[model samples]
Target: MNLSFFDQFASPSLMGIPLIIIAMMFPALLLIHQDNRWITNRLSTIQSWLLHMITKQLMIPLNKKGHKWSLILMSLMMLLLTINLLGLLPYTFTPTTQLSMNMALALPLWMATLLTGLRNQPSISLGHLLPEGTPTPLIPALILIETTSLLIRPLALGVRLTANLTAGHLLIQLISTATIALLPIMPTVSILTSLILLLLTMLEIAVAMIQAYVFVLLLSLYLQENI
Candidate 1:
């Protein structure tokens, strides 16, 4: 009732201290490892298995040089996954919903892949701008289009991630708020809305997990192209 719908997206702060920093650190703190032994707990075992599966899948198309990125890619995946899922809780900010943060994440990584290609295979990299056997008249236009697309990759990445997460969060909030308001007036309809809200919550959970994977998967694909 207090904060406007959009205001909820604003970074939370207290006493002039920005708590978004703590929100960013929360996931890392939760991920800290405190146990090391031959016989690990079931939770640790499952965590290891999940990471192994993800790393193997991401590496399938990568060569030896690209394999060096598996660790960083996997860590990024885990961090995004943790923060996204955590943000689904009662009161927490989803940092990934912010365009600035997503862009910061996308730009440098995309640039790295682009630079890697230019450094290792300049001919092929620049050659991607123009395809072979193009009609003479269309050559200029095709090259311009391809170059624009290549430059737009990072913007697409950041916007895609931020938009999807923001839309899902907004939908959930709208539905939940309606359910609460309707409860006092119409109990039966409220119950129905609540059920829908439950299902949507489950779907948002899947979206959170999938979007994180997609973010990493796309980066790996970009890496694949470059390497």
Candidate 2:
């Protein structure tokens, strides 16, 4: 619950980010180093195959016209996604839980949406963003509402990740403290709490993946709708 400086530096960032960025890149580098050998073969190919499947499933749209741009987006998504899930391990820190980290990811997408929208349709970019059809008299009110909602994307993204990770970590901390306190006669509760924490850990993994995907999906859709 505490955003202490000691805890922040507990996971030292090479350049103000988690080491997981480097960790995640290892698999990608391995695939290249092996000359895509990981993709071939049969028995020892499941994990690589799954990674390929995920990359393909998510990278479909990105593979189109702006391939390089797509690569950038997918890379960020994959890297963040890996970090989110892997940080659930014992003695690990989830960077996404930090506001600075979350803002680092969200702000770029927000700016991209705005820039792309303007680039694609400069004629009435800002004006037309207020829904296509509305009562003429409510023009000012409608524009205000639409503008507020549009600007909220980054805020929503940051809050969603921070809230989820903080809540998950808090629950784990509470359970751990409870188990320690009950280690006397009610040893069974400690065991039960450990099991529950394990279950929640697994759920956290899924939530991590889902949150990354949702962020990327929403970003792509935002671009598509506006641009």
Candidate 3:
């Protein structure tokens, strides 16, 4: 069921920009509150333990740059997670399904990857961006294809997230709406659909976390590759 697109301005007062604004503040507040020697010492101890456990996969030392990257990614994940959970309420909406919101999250990472690659390895970054050992005859074709595919990554990521959230929300709405419509004739089917939606809602919560993790992990991998 394809519902009309929800406008950014045409939202409930409490569920509109205010909700997203507050959601975005969660990470900032956390970081701000932890800005101290005690929190720093505790975080250092935890990071050391984490590094010891993942010694084998350690591609680079967690320097200032790495720490900042991790902080930014974690903040994004937290913000998205909060917004998603908020949408599960009685009359709230998920801003993540909005193209503008998703792209706002995706484009910066894409730009960061491009800038990092160029900044770190200015001399050979372009050459390395294309695969090695391409036949001279097919070089142009390969470059064209690879460039297009590279550009599509962020687009695909944005669309994938938006589509999933929209689909799940629509499913819940349809089930509930149908249940109300057929309450007298087919209460059992409506009840079953509602149960399925409830289960789906639970699964979607997990999915929201998974999506955030995957996005951050991929961004890390992209950064690692450049360095």
Say which candidate scores most in TM-score.
1
TM-score of each: 0.96, 0.77, 0.75
TM-score winner between 2 and 3, please give it.
Answer: 2
Provide the global lDDT of candidate 2 against the true structure.
Answer: 0.70
Better of 2 and 3 by lDDT: 2
Error of 2 at 220 (Å): 1.1
Worst ten in a row by lDDT for model 3: 1-10
lDDT per residue as tens, model 3, 1-227: 24343332233356344565554454445432334565467666774565444332333444445555765665566577667666666666677777778888898887887788788786565775478888899998898998787788788778877887777777667677777877788888878877877898898788776766566566666666565
In order, what lDDT does every prediction score? 0.91, 0.70, 0.67
TM-score of 1: 0.96
Q: lDDT per residue, candidate 1, 37-77, as tens digits?
A: 77887877788889899999999999999999999899999
Q: Model 3 compared with the native: what TM-score?
A: 0.75
Off by over 4 Å in 2: 1-52, 55-68, 123-128
Which residue pairs in candidate 3 have backbone atoms (N, alpha carbon, C) closer than 3 angstroms, thus clashing?
none
**Cand. 3 Cα-lDDT:** 0.67
Candidate 3 residues lying further than 4 Å off, grouped into runs, are 1-23, 26-65
Listing every candidate in turn, what is its Cα RMSD in Å to the true structure after a full C-alpha superposition?
1.5, 4.1, 5.0
- Model 1 spans with C-alpha error above 4 angstroms: 1-3, 32-35
Q: Which residue pairs in model 1 clash with each other?
A: none
Worst ten in a row by lDDT for model 2: 27-36
